[model samples]
Target: METESVEYVKQTMEYSRKRAIRTKLVNFVINKIWKVPIFYSESRAEGISSVQSDTDFMFEADGIFTLSNEGQIGLKSDTSVVYVVMDTHEVHSGYTRIQIMEGDWNDLSEFASSGDGLRSLCKTFGNHNSKYLSNILVKQFWETRMKSVIPRQGLKNEISSHGPSTVIRYAADKDVVEVDTLICLRGEWPEVAKEWLERKRNFNWPTKELIEEIKAIGCNLVPIGHRLSHGKELELEWRISFSKAECLLIWSLNGTQTACIECMRLFFQVFISPKFPDLFSSYFIKTAMFWLIEETDSTFWQPLNILACLDRLLSKLITCVEEKCIQNFFIPKNNMLDAKAVESKELLDVLRIELTRHDVTGEEKWRMLIKEKLLQMDKNDIYYYHILINSLSVSRHFIYNSIRSSNIKDSKDMLMQGIQELKCCNDKDMFSDVCKQLQHELEAILSIVTFCESQSDSGTDRILSPNDTKWVEETLNKYTELSHSTGKLLLCTFYFYIERYQEALAITEDVQTRYTSQVVHYTFWNRSKTPRDDHYPQITPRPTLNETLKNYIALDVVLLPCLSRLFRATIQEKLYSRDALFIHPLFYAFFVRFHCFYRMQNAAECEAVLNKMQTFVAENMDVLKTTQDFNILHLGDSCHQLLKKHTESGNYFKKTIKSLLQKGEF
Candidate 1:
């Protein structure tokens, strides 16, 4: 019997823990490490294998928490976490592979097995699973679309590129009771991003209409790196999909097609897999089956021809290993066989000999066994087997009903309806729900506005009308209950955009604080001339004093951007005073009294602020490098230039400032 006591098991970087770990890690990095203050990337979560770090590295971490602009705790992370990130340094763009910070898996699993969790485990959510699974499939829909468009004139370049592969890690099966995560890429195959333009019917609301659309078009593509095509460099791309197309195609067959694929998988898993576990992977045969089916007509896949299909698929894999080439169906340039080519060839040769010896004199032992066991076999496919999905898919009844009742006609109609709904909704009881709906509608509007802006940047379209921007600002800021960190940032940005500088500054106050995180450092013994690894003595504050000061400097730098120039001197005075409201005791207290003086037409004070700015930069040169959160991409070079210019142009800067103010450039 399992005890009530929650025994904490050491976390590991295992396939079973990937999804949970990734969720936790993303929370940790976004809140603590990267401190992502502004831009967002839903297009992340897919990457090459190298981003992963040791499980121990993450487990040792005591996660840091972030405060919202209100100075309230924002998002926090459990120790067991993993993150998917881009290739940017500070590791900001990308995420570490597996970072396990904290969590009691024992109690959680037991809790999951009790009452509510147990009840949820029994519910059916097939439609919901398929609905959510569609985002990663968007690229797939485009593939067939592109095929037809390619033959049309002047369309090739317009649709030259494709994106995404299905991230199956976030998907689920029908029987799964736990809410399994499903992520599919050209790595998330069909993640259908919401558009700037709304959909006709269920436009603002979540609906089944959206689900069908995703099922039709979402997909992901692989990045095989760049190669020369003609005289120009062309990116070589492929796809890593437990393919919806193949599943749909196989389903389209008359009968027993699913059974045939199942049989082949069983053959590999039961026999071939044991012989060469690493090289003759279960996927090799299934991949071959998908390719063969794609090439053959529907007439070729029948109940009677199941055996033939299986045989042909196996032969195809054998040939692929022999030739060291398994071309992807869509992207012919991608060679799937390269990684295990040599090993697969050796295995296939050995298997052929083994088969010949065992099945002599008309004894088809392997074939007979596979066919007989087909019915009893579970639906074992790559997508289902490899993905870390929920046991139970969440119910979307509310969204379904909303879309059903609204019956929106098109994007424009949806937008109009949303506007009407917002105007009518005044009840405080429904505040949170209403705010969420409003935010979605606003996001839709913003996407279109941003789209037009991007087009303008590329000279293809004009900028959005001022009315469109005003509408977005109004909509985005209407939610008074919006306490989310991202939402607060958006609110601050909205105030900034509307030229409500005072409001923007007020909103920024909560972010102006001292923040610190614990990092472990170890001392090592110097053996010979090299070094012997060893643990450093544990100290209360830290093993080193430099790191602590660095935190103080970093916090100060973050607040500097939002600081009022007039009060720069006041802040500088309070730097060492206990009256400060900031977190870090040494928050940047540079005297900006000069700015206030200049604005007040007081020459003496004006000169002081500039001197203080220069002095402040010079004094903290050592800890300045820690300000990665501020996005001062090349702070070192830029700061150096500013310091040099300020020093050299000392007196002349006063005249320049006066000119700037006279010209209204201030």
Candidate 2:
């Protein structure tokens, strides 16, 4: 018996060790494959770490890895960059319709004298009205300015070039990794964008400084290229980009706003996109966020209002999704969503389904997305896997369905079976598999509940009664001990919408009690809290195995509404001050607290935040001390200057809060 027990323990140890190694390998491969530069990572736009692709070791033939300013991944000795996506600092979501500018300009004075300049040239090259320009001035631009020796490619390589835009395709990581480089200029900017340019006050985009210092002399060009759309007349259109200015705009976002934007993007990507297909691009979401910020004050963008802001954005998106409209930030005439509606009305239909609440005015979708339910009881596999498969089939069909005609009731019955299987399954391994597969069914269940209760969509709303809410709350809480963080996250979201803010905050804690639940969302938001916003929901986009880790689920933004109840007393007392450690988000929290102070017109607390921020950066931060660049110290000096500017201007929350405070209601 002793020997048998010892053997069992040895087997368990070996299994555990192998599992850890497998997990580590998956993490390493995924990060190394996709990670770009720390400052401007596309991985954040997509994913930080992923488990989507297989780690193919079949090609052990050519091994290499390397890194560069762009965070290139290849062999250490092999830093062969075939192309660079020139001026990547300017890259953003909305700038689409790539147009390649061509031809020569030996004489600028001829066109510089004309009032239209590049615009006149664009009309001459195209049939003179709608088309912009082609065969105009690209060769002269690249040839004269480039000092570096031009490369001559040797055999078996390809260059697909048009005007200035060239795609230099190259491979890394034993040629398993492929990348394309683009060369283009900022073009096609409208008058509204110029008006926006005049509004800039802070340390603008690095490109903005470049433009001001060198090109204030007013050199200009018309970039002409064909649109990416297929089967068109191929008219040359003048296109431009404002990516540089936009990057600076992104930098101005404080921690709260950034987090909120990311969360909203995640929501659009996860719930909205799957149902709507290619209709909701990241650009549409980002442009809406930017427009919303322009309409609000800094206090309105604070952590406490993150969800409220997202709610407003979503309400607006419902209009865009339904009416097939989303206006471009720089060009209001460019409705970004119009082109997305050509394929079918399925996306519009799917959105309506999800957004449809008894009280919510926006969404109304088809009941079921599957045309026919498959069942073959003679097969043992079908009998075992049918419930799981059918639930996801219905869930995904609505997402992938473009036909717009799938409203059969295949899932309603499968859902019942799934619940039954959960209750009956006793085999731990089989039960885990069912839970993993049935998570979709769970999400479908919760999205409906969330939609009904959130009251997020504007239109006279209906609230779930206490009994109904409690029932749903009890149902959500069932997974609290089941190692499913998503279920817990859903439960916390339920608590947040239902106004149980204390319980919502306690969901992240190891031990829970009424007294310990004092950690309100903004309490942690404005304080120098240890653990930060870690857990992003798993049900977002697609579920990968790695998201099961506890730290990956975030709940703070949803709970931020609790701040409205707590901020007045804290700002009034002029208490609670702290300095940030390196990367602890200490400075960010204090920045928020100071803004709260400013909003309340509490001058003393605002000054306290600035003094502490300055001193902390000067003294404690190792990175700042080593670099001696005060800007790197949590962007310290810039933030100080902003606060100082605000103080000097005496424009303290002039929008909503100040007006209310002056009226004695706040």
Candidate 3:
């Protein structure tokens, strides 16, 4: 039973490891788009998939430098640059006070010079003539600034402050994660941590090469002050954060070690936190793990001995609490524990009881805890589907944000790599099946876009050759095998583009008859609820995608003959909108149908199709009004104009079609 329980725990950690890989892959794409220094922190990035964990992100402040001394600010004397010199005198260990050295006050922004900002935070030392920036005041200002800026970006979450970070607590109705973002300043490696670099170790958990790499990465100054500081020191001191280094260290841990850390965190959160409230923090648990890993032999940290490891870690935690001192891993002089000695004793009592309940061995007690948590979680196919869905959702978000701004080729390559990695993670499950379908859809979209680009390059008389038509048919067949409505609609557009009116009209009529609410539209967003189908009953909420939505194609798949010229003109005129490039599948199907009728000189059929489209639009106006679903008004007006022309004069309608085709415009 012990071996089985430990194996189960290890298996659970594998799930989390795969999740972390997927998240990192998405983050790699996001980092490319933002082109800034951003770090994902805490549980999500650390391979902990606990539902209770909040997503933490840190953005390094731009144009800001933290130097060890004024001498280091040699050539950065430009007015646009802000520099602060770290002062370690009389400060707590693992903390420093930064003094503004050189920069225009305006560089800090208008708020910094205002009475409510830095002016209010200024304080003169008793004997010194200079003033230092107050960590507390900086944190407060950033919190206020973030709260104001976030709502402007359309995130109306409830924003509040926690330490140096701004917490965005999403409402229950919102399908978003709770996020904590911190604005930090990068600095050179702190002198206090030099000892950790050279510290003697019995077991080299983080090898010398790792230490050197971490040193090169340096540290960041968080806005929060040391908790143990008094008087003005409390407001002026900044804590030295090794968040980047800590992340690297956690990533270096083997499977067993990582699983042990997760279990320690879970134990603390589920068993200890509710009873002991603020006596200790999750950081204490992490810090203890670092020490435990360094002190124990590497061979002992294996899968079969996870329970033993957890027991040893628990013993370490109890020792720390009893001694009332949990040393910072990087700076040993800094005790992380507070002065709540009585509470510590009580917590130690609880830990002792839990570790040896009913005369149970410590390893047996830990095995029971691991088994209990695993039972509470949905450790089945559903969990794997959730990971796959989240990965696809993030990838979609990346593509949506970068489609217009970044290179299309890079976006496609990244998405392909992501899908491939996801397939490797779960080869025989629903996860792999969904990935395969998505891959096919992506290839079809790419083929259509490539064809459009070829047409644009070949210029005016560019008509589809026999080979091109055959390729289109093949792509459409493949896509249709996976998705009927979207694939057939795409084929219908291709037929209209090639002037095959009867073929296009037949496809539209067939699609209209078969279209239902069950047909999912390809869009930038993913649906929260899956379609109620008999397939994949094990994964209730599986994600589905119809097309690889890219900016290169107009209207999801339609690319006009003069698209390049028109796109350039649109960009120059600043008349480009995402709505112009994308339309709902239903709207697109009707739009193509209306054009087909206009081309064939069927006034009655055009009018009838226009009325049906308008009716559908009218019925969903309220819902459409809330979202950017389909620009029904825009498409409806275009169809109405075509209908008007068909009714006015057949000769003039024929002339209109000739003029549009001659101009190579849609």
Candidate 4:
């Protein structure tokens, strides 16, 4: 029975391992699109789907450098450089004070004074004394800046500051994923953690090579102080954040070791947290896991011994609570449990009782707890998957919107990397399929846009060569099995571009008849209210025709740079600022139908199609505006004028189409 229990735990851990792979692949794509360097927090990055873990992101601030000593200041002599020197003297363990060494202070100053240039970031003791920057002030500055910036980026959520990080709560109905972002300054490896490199470890968990890599990676100084610091120290001290190093170490851990840590975290969240809210935290559990992994033999972290490893971790936690000394993994002198000592008595007693039980009853109790935790994780898996898909979709949308002629190669390289990495995770077939579909679609769109740019630059006609038509046909056909309406509509656009009016008209009629509300025209402008139900309805849900249509069929027809010339003459300069508008797939279908009729000289059919489009726009105006980036109101007026002018003179319609075709505008 004990072996069976361990086997069950191993199965759960295997599930988590697969999830971790998927999470990393998705995050890799997301990170590539981010403009600044970012570090995803440990638990989420590691694919621990426990609800207790919040997704945290640390962004390194640009143009702000941190120096370990005055000697390095000479290395950065640029007048525009903003830098701070680390002052480690007389500070708490794992904490330092940063003295501003260069740059114009007035540039950052909101209140200008006669002596604004001489003003310090925080406070100065004397005229000759160095002005030390305050961690509190830095945090306040970032929080204020982020609050002002987040809304402009289209996130309407209220931003708040929590310690060193800014928190954004994305609330959908009752489900909320709180994302914490910390802005920090990168610096050389801290002198305080240098001893960790030389520390004796019997197992040598983090090899010398890994240690060297971490040392070379350096560290960050977050705007946070020690919890036990006094008033002045609290304001002045900056915490030396080993988040990057910690993430690297966590990433290097074996699957069982990672699972063991996750189990310990689950134990803390379920059994300990509710009763003793502030007694300890997941970080304490993580620190204990690091210490245990270093002390124990590497083979002890095998799948069969996962429960035992978890037990050992719980024992270590109890020891920490009892002694009130949980040391920081990198800087052992910094006792993580120091501030929580006052609240540890009851928690210590409870943990000691829990750990001392080694009998069958205790074993059975743990089994029950593990089972319950696994069940909870299973339930939350859908929600986590929803978040992952949404994140991937949003990242793709951002990448597509940001892509220009200059960055096309870089964007393509990034997407290709995502595709290759996603393909390597063979165990996650469904996830890989969905992710690959998205990647291929984006890659296709990018390739077509690039091709269009090249053709436009060469002053070629819009007509496709035999090879170009074959490639376009093959690409559109790939989507046929998955997204019928989207593929047909894009194919229709291709035919129209090549002046195949009969084929294009037939496709438009078919799409118009088959199009329904079920087709998902995804845009970042409006998020689906029921993301879980719409995208991830089942665990390992197979990609059905309808599911693919809902998730993968973005109707991203507007992204074709070749098609942009067709609408460029109609759209205003203000609308052109967005480069391309995401039109409603249905509206685009009818719009294509109107074009086909206009080209065929069927004025009655063109007028009928225009009326249908007008009705569609009128009925779904609010929805279209919310879900698409296009100016439907302006488009409607343009269509109305075109049709009215066509009725006034047949020569005007014929001449307009002729001029547009001759100029390769369509």
Candidate 5:
């Protein structure tokens, strides 16, 4: 009996809840949907009524109609919410009507019964679900209850501040409910969102006209105007109801800006004239003068305009840098003492001063400054080239440090951009210098790559490999045809060292003309010792034949001895060609000659080779005695050692002597 009574109470509560929900929904449809205004007086006077439950009031183009089971309103669901079609007096009043919609009664009923719907909705909306679902009942009411109000033009006021909102109490004496005014505001206003809403609702002036007016000012809009205008100074202060700090900076940009332009022209004239006096042609100088002025005052740094300017400027600058003074644009470390280094130092000082003065430290400014200087540099000037390299190196280090410390990924492109500039260095010696630095850098980056690649589920390796390939291709491609071959070769060496062999091979093969025998040997020796055994062996069989080796007797001697050892003991000795033996004898003799030429002592190993060579020569002595220029071929200690070792071992120069005898018969 008690359980039955409890069940009855539960059923009663559920029924009441449903009835209350239906009532609220229906009221919203009638009031808000029907364009009704529910007014409440803050004062209890004039025979006004007090509130009970939420009520409905309607304003229609036609007269209100009482329901007679006749009027056609689009209410499809069994829920109490309904749609009424009518024209509302708002924007360009056409045949527009409100569409009534069913409320979430059925969904709510299912949610209450099963609890699954509530959980799903909670997951969907997260923390917002409680607020959204609970207030679902009031949403339709507010939507239908809205009224379109007329905008009022308010008084204009000037205030000094960086805040975005400026309020003016225009026509304060009048009973006006709406006002519109163009408030010169800053971008940093705390109530910016609120100001945006106010403007949208006619509480504040719209921005479209203001933007157009600023555009018509015949001066560009910027965070701070140029020297002819405000010059980063606070020029005026005005007060208003919103916030008092809304300051508008004003100046006669024409007069002042023109004067500043002339100043820039003079500055560019005298500053670089002494150094690059003949560097810029008359035509180019004139173009540069105009460009300098335009750059000084044009809205080049505006948020919307900056990227486009950078892109266009880069296109122009890249050609100029490639052809003219690319070196002036860079400052590699080795050339810091050059005159262009002095210029770069001065440029850095200027940038620092600008930053200090304006309290602005923007990466774009730094990048643009570097690029601009690069574009202006004379490409043929050695000093300028060094300076450009040095500058890029400095920037690379700065970006790398920043990226490392912050764990930011955005600096990836900046670092890469600096590296790209690095690759453009056409001077082999200078490029080599930069490549060494990059090789060291890759060690650190490689470790990071390894760590990232170790993640079990990460697909980063696939992404990183292609990215690395692209980076390498972009960095090394320009120098493939130029004088920077030595550096490029070394760069390839390190790349291969890091297991990026395919790219290394591609670059190295193209630049083979630059390879000295010493370089070939060094490259091959490093390859032999690489951790990647499979790759090293693949190249092992490749002959280290460089033209530079023709004159390098020492390498021939070393290589010949090593190759001869392979032939001496093998049953398949005939498989080794004469060219193989030709390389060995030449290699050993050259080394022995080197040691003797330099007056160095024969080491114990040399003493051994000397004995072997002597025995070989003694057996073949008759051959040499019969051959022309035998006296010119002065047999050294290596030959002496070969004969002595063989004689002491009791071979007695047998086979060699027979061959020498046969040669003598000829």
Candidate 6:
């Protein structure tokens, strides 16, 4: 009974050894054919290593074997053969065995080729038993398996009809089969996504940090996908395989590895194509402008590179804009009115600011062209009116700042030409139209001063506000005798400048009370005309003359308080000493400028007028600094918040002036 038990135990040991060998063989075969690294299972048993061992031989055969072991296979006709052994029972002897198959020369080679094809045939047949095989392969493997491992229908038969049965079967349970089948689906992803994910996975594409950013930007995926293809495809296209939401998420979060023009184009393409086709061109153009503008501010990067890119983008954008407008059917999804105008204005503001740093000839030319375009925009088009006006003003200021150092006399000529264009429009019927022309002329004149200052110290002194002053004088003179109420109001401004205060007061009062029915629409004058004749007199004016102009001028008088403050500040700053020098004439010039601002009833215009005044102060800042006078400082301080601070002062002044201007109010 003990002897029987020992024999049974020995038999069990043999069986375990055989199982280990087969397992290794299966693993080796899979690695060789699939090129997938073999990871041993925890339950796998160790096997003897030898070329003829089932595992070793089969695995190597996948790499180098040329024939099947089950067939009459030979390397050469009637001479050579390869054999493999699967068992090892003789402990002292070489456990692996080999056998040679001999055949006719042609038949031998044909057998070898057929035998070689058997391995592929087995893979096609597939094994449901091996856990290793079941776990490693994915659904994607099926396509490759079908293409290479399996022969076409009727062309090759996997089952043998009459031969040594080579089909080795190990019992596979239902659970094992199901596990193997399901394993093909797990840990599997699209090949395209896999490749992209592998490249950027660790580096972080569509990172969690970028979640909010991804959502805000729609259609950002196109560029990102195209970029992943290294721009082999147009970025505008979306791969149909990916859901739109997924694509968008990827796109918004993906950042370019570099920022060259090509990359920028691709980056721009992602969002532009999907979310904002209509706005794409304009935004790109504006972005280019911003880049160039920033480059102008500092030579932080290569300006030439930026400029070249800008030119390309702007050209493309211009074409797109013209095309969209022409098509008419291309309504922007954003419903933004005049997108170009908004972009141009914003970009131009930044550009104008940045231009203070560069002195390049090319930069100047570019700036000039941009300014010219702004000036050319229609005054009636409110979409661009204010922005264009601001741009023009800034450009004019920039030009004046550069004019002094300019070697070219043509600069001055060009500025004068702009003035001429504006003057040509001054004959229009509308008061606003005439005012616009005159204002443009004023801006042009201011540009001249800046231009002269930029040219040279010698030319700096030549910058005269006198030209604008002269124009103002002429405009006032021309309007003084005109029958129009606006013209008469303009004449009162002239009186204020020439220091004819009483006369100025008289004209204001006449229009205020006598013509309140007609001119009450002009709110300021009606308010100014309500008091005594000593300070405000009701002059003889009929139905045509209006109080609006007078009230406006009177309200303008509120600015005097600010002027008083500014003068006092100026004195404190020693802009002028009380007893040292004459100051009335200079103050008169300030008055005339203030009158123009007050008459317009435009806050922005008034601010612009104040800025010009500030410019004058800045021009003479050195002089003021030297004096350190209290009176000048006071004056400067007075002007600081003139319109805003002294709102009620105008009303009181209006009451006081009523008696002076009135024919009968006193």
Would you list the rank order by lDDT, best first? Answer: 4, 3, 2, 1, 6, 5
- Give the clashing residue pairs of candidate 4, or none: none
lDDT of 4 by residue, 295-355 (tens): 9999888867766777777777767777879899999998877766654556667765654
Model 2 misplaced regions, further than 4 Å = 1-132, 135-180, 186-192, 195-233, 342-346, 355-666
User: Model 6, 480-552: lDDT tens per residue?
Assistant: 3332234444455445543555665566555444443222111110121122223333344422212222232
Cand. 3 TM to true fold: 0.64
Q: Is candidate 3 or candidate 5 better by TM-score?
A: 3
Looking at model 1, which ten-residue stretch has the lowest summed lDDT?
A: 1-10
**The best candidate in terms of TM-score:** 4
Stretches of model 6 off by over 4 angstroms after superposition: 1-384, 395-474, 477-494, 506-666
Roughly what TM-score does model 2 have, to 2 decimal places? 0.32
Error of 4 at 119 (Å): 7.7
What local distance difference test score does each model get?
0.31, 0.35, 0.61, 0.62, 0.28, 0.30
The C-alpha TM-scores of every prediction are 0.27, 0.32, 0.64, 0.68, 0.17, 0.19
* Tens digit per residue, CA lDDT, model 3, 436-540: 655665566566556655665688586657886788678877776555555677677667777888888888787666555444333332342343333224434
**Off by more than 4 A, model 5:** 1-395, 403-666
Scanning candidate 3 in windows of ten residues, the lowest lDDT window is: 546-555
Pick the winner on TM-score between candidates 2 and 4: 4
Overall local distance difference test of candidate 3: 0.61
What is the Å distance of residue 531 in model 4 from its true position?
A: 12
RMSD of each predicted structure:
24.7, 29.0, 10.3, 9.5, 35.6, 39.6
Q: What is the lDDT of residue 24 in candidate 4?
A: 56
Which of candidates 1 and 4 reaches a greater TM-score?
A: 4
What does candidate 5's lDDT look like per residue over 557-628, in tens digits?
111111121112220132132111111222233223323322334445445444554554555443344322
